[model samples]
Target: MNKNLRVPVGIFGIFLIIAITLTYTLNNLFYLVNFLYIGSILSIGIYLFVINNKYGRHLVQFTIGLYMVIFLGIILQENMQLSGFFYYLFLGVFQAAVIHYAIAKIFGPVLFGRGWCGYACWTGMVLDILPFKTPKNHERVKNLGLLRYMIFILIFIGVLILFYLNVPNLDYLMFIIFILGNLIYYAVGIVSAYILKDNRAFCKYFCPITTFLKPASYFSLLRVKNTSEKCIKCNKCINNCPMDVDMLDNRRKRKNGTECILCLECISNCPTKSLKI
Candidate 1:
């Protein structure tokens, strides 16, 4: 077996376990289909990444991102946004957005790092398509990163307020909020990309989900590590990274380490093939 194939296979196996377990426990086949589809796409993307396909990551993004936004959010009216998660949480419903947050946004990062941002997030889906791929570290606004936590807290408080107020037509309102939220995210993400000259500007500066993701992904098992022997003092990896991760510094506490999305841009750009997951 090719060494590069191992990670994809491992991810596929893990997704299968999650899918099967959810299906068995929930007695709903939707869990099986949903997870199986997600797992297959992720495995395929990782495999293509191994084969050096430039579109490999984009393939997964479009596949999963479109489904979540179009099928789940619009067609099904599931409201998979951040508000939706809190909505379900306050309602004590263990379905839909809460499950997504638990599995993808929160706990999953411990295993895959910020894979959600890289591969599955609908917000990132649109942002990745914009012209700026690499980050403009120089132009990054100071203290703007604090906005993410603020946004996160505001959203939480908003949801809690709604719960306290006992709003009527809650389901319908959530669906509407889902649509509005996506529009706002797209608008902000795109403008920020152009303004900051960084495609991931919104992610780095304003994504509230990072509040959950960063803490757990700080201990991610899968991340890029560089071997000093093959490193020729070239800074290609750092220069190419969209998220500005200091991947060459192999330490748990490396600068911007938790920000890594496991995108492998650093790995492919390495001149001596020294970087790997």
Candidate 2:
């Protein structure tokens, strides 16, 4: 078997394990189908990426993003947003948004890093199509990253307030908030992209989910590695990174190491093919 093919196969096996485990533990067949679908699409996308298909990553983004936003969020009213996670959590419900957050935004990052941001995020799926695939200024805005934590705290407080007040029709209200939250995310993401000339401005500066993703992702099992022998110091990889990760340095404590989303833009642009995952 080709070495590159191992990545997708390994990823598929991991998802299969999760699917089976969740199905058995929860006694719900929905988890089997849900995780199987996600795994299949992700495996296929990774396979395409290995074959050097330019549209491979986009394929995963669109299929998974649309399914989450349209089918889960809108049609099924699952409210898979950050607020929805808190809502389900506060109600002591282990299903729906809580499960989604656990597997995707929380513990899962320890295994796959922020692959969700790269290939499965509904918000990122939209922002990626903007004109700035790479930022005009490679330097990140000073202290702007602090906004994500503030937003995280505010959302936590907002949910606590709702639960404290015993808000009526809470389920329906969560659905409404989910829709409005996505709209606000899209608006802020797009506006920030144009203003910052970086397609990932919202992710870098304002996404509350990063508060969960970043901490665990510091120990991600999967990450890009750089070969010093092949590196000619052309700086193309750093120049192309959307997340400003210093992937050239293989150390775990490298600058912005936790910010890596596994987008592979750095690898793809590496002049000497020095970067790999």
Candidate 3:
């Protein structure tokens, strides 16, 4: 096998394991099919990326994002949002939303960092098409990240209120929230992108999902590394990074390291090819 193919194969194998395990444990064929579909698409995207296809990441984003947002969320009425995760958790149901959160949002980050944000996020799929792929201002706004925490807390509280009130037709309400929440996210994300001149402005400042994604991703097994010997200090990697990660630092605590989506812009932009996963 070619060395470059290893990562994509490994990714597919991991998802295959998850699919088989969940199918057996939960006695649901949907788990097997859903995960297999997602795994295949992701593996193809990674292979395209390895071959230096510039749109590989976007391809994955649209395929998986549209499936989750349109098929699972709208057609199946599964919600698939933070509110839906909480609702399913409260009901003790190990369904689509719960399984998705567990695999894609919570525990999965320990291995892949914010790969979900880069390759599979429905919100990011839309945002990445915006004009500002790289922020005009290379620095993040001070203290704006606190808004994610606030939004996280508010979602939790709102879910609690629904459960406490024993809201009738709770499933319907959650589905409604899912639609409205996505609309609001898209609206705010687009507006913020233009205002801040950054495509990921919403992810940086307002996404409640990051509150779950960042901590585990800090210890992610996959991360970009820099080879100092090959580096010419050209700073192209940093300048090209959408997340403003200090990829040259080669430390777990590197500036904005937790924010890295493993997008590989730094590697692609490196003049000396000093950066690698």
What 10-residue stretch in candidate 1 is worst by lDDT? 133-142
TM-score, every prediction: 0.97, 0.97, 0.98
Off by over 4 Å in 2: 2-4
Write model 1 residue lDDT over 97-185, tens digit each, in one string. Answer: 88999999899888888999999998998898899999757345789999999999999999889889989988899899899998999
Tens digits of per-residue lDDT for model 3, 1-277: 9987998999899999999999999999999999999999999999999999998899999999999999999999998999999999999998999989998889999999999999999999999999999986778899999999999999999999999999999999999999999999999999999999999999999999999999999999999999659799898999889999988798899999999998899999998998878
What is the alpha-carbon lDDT of model 1 when measured against the actual structure?
0.89
Cα-based lDDT for every prediction: 0.89, 0.92, 0.93
Clashing pairs in 3: none
After superposing candidate 3 on the true structure, give the runs of residues whose Cα lies further than 4 Å from its correct spot: none
| Predicted candidate 2 versus true structure: per-residue lDDT over 144-248, tens digit per residue | 999999999999999889988999998899899999999999999999999999999999999999999999999999899996596998889988998888887
**How high is the lDDT of residue 206 in model 3?**
93
On TM-score, the stronger of 1 and 3 is 3
Please name the candidate that would achieve the greatest TM-score relative to the true structure. 3
TM-score between model 3 and native: 0.98
**Candidate 1: which pairs clash?**
none
